[model samples]
Target: MSKSELDEIINRSLELRKKYHELELTHHGSHWSVEEDALAFLTDAGLVGRNIMSQQERWPKAHSASELEHKIGESIWWLIVLADRSGMDVKAALENFLSKTEKLLDQ
Candidate 1:
């Protein structure tokens, strides 16, 4: 997807949260809470662990491959929103980290 499409997805998620609040009368009633965020991370970690277990089992395929991708995408979206809430620019932070890593590797 293009940058514009990604932006639209982010905007749509924001709108969905707004609608959720309208119906629930509470902030994050239908959105991600800290516990939910931790659970998401744990879920993704479990997927990764399962993938490792599959490798150990000598399986030729991964279980929940598509779901794993979706989870990863969701994690990224959550990170982006969290960064925005924390007043940080995700793109800038990524660029800075990459640059710093390159410099450290060169030393």
Candidate 2:
């Protein structure tokens, strides 16, 4: 995809998440506590990993496939927002991480 398309996707993702937060407030009547949200996302990541593993099995059904995809997408959104909040460039962070991993493997 073009850079502009990627940017649009990111922007839309952020907007959708903001709406989700609003809905949560409307129903749950409270903002997600930071610690709770972190723990919940971590738990979700673990579940996604399990879903991926199941899909790798010799015989697997597409159970909750869309939900799994949505969760993974949402997890990415969470990471992007977290990085932004922390004043870090997500692209730069990924590049630095990959560079370090490559150097380490070459050692």
Candidate 3:
């Protein structure tokens, strides 16, 4: 995807996260802490892994493809939200990681 497209996705993800934060405040009296957010992301990540295992017949319980797709998307969204919560520029972090990994592998 283009840089602009990625930026737009990041912007929208944060915007939606802000809305969720507000909802949490309204319902629970406070937004989730960073650790809480990380745990939530981990929960979804585990579900993604479980879904993959099910597809491989390693997991006893099965989840539909659509369910797995939704979890995958949610996992990515959670990562974006988590980065923002941690005061990170997700795009820059990703670029740096890719550049460093590529250079390391090339060496």
- Candidate with the greatest TM-score versus the true structure: 3
lDDT of 2 by residue, 1-107 (tens): 77688678767766876787798899999866666567777877877786776667623656577877987987887776666556787768877999999999999
Where is model 3 more than 4 Å wrong at Cα? none
Task: List, residue by residue over 12-93, the lDDT tens digit for candidate 3.
Answer: 9999989999999999999999999999999999999999999889889865899899999999999999989899999988
- Return model 2's CA RMSD, one decimal: 3.0
lDDT of each: 0.66, 0.74, 0.93
After superposition, which runs of candidate 1 have C-alpha atoms over 4 Å from their true positions? 1-39, 42-62
Provide the lDDT at 59 for model 1: 55
lDDT (Cα, 0-100) at 73 in candidate 3: 93
Candidate 2 lDDT at 59 equals: 35
User: In the order shown, what is each candidate's alpha-carbon RMSD?
Assistant: 4.3, 3.0, 1.0
**Superposition error at 2 for model 1 (Å):** 6.8
Clashing pairs in 1: none
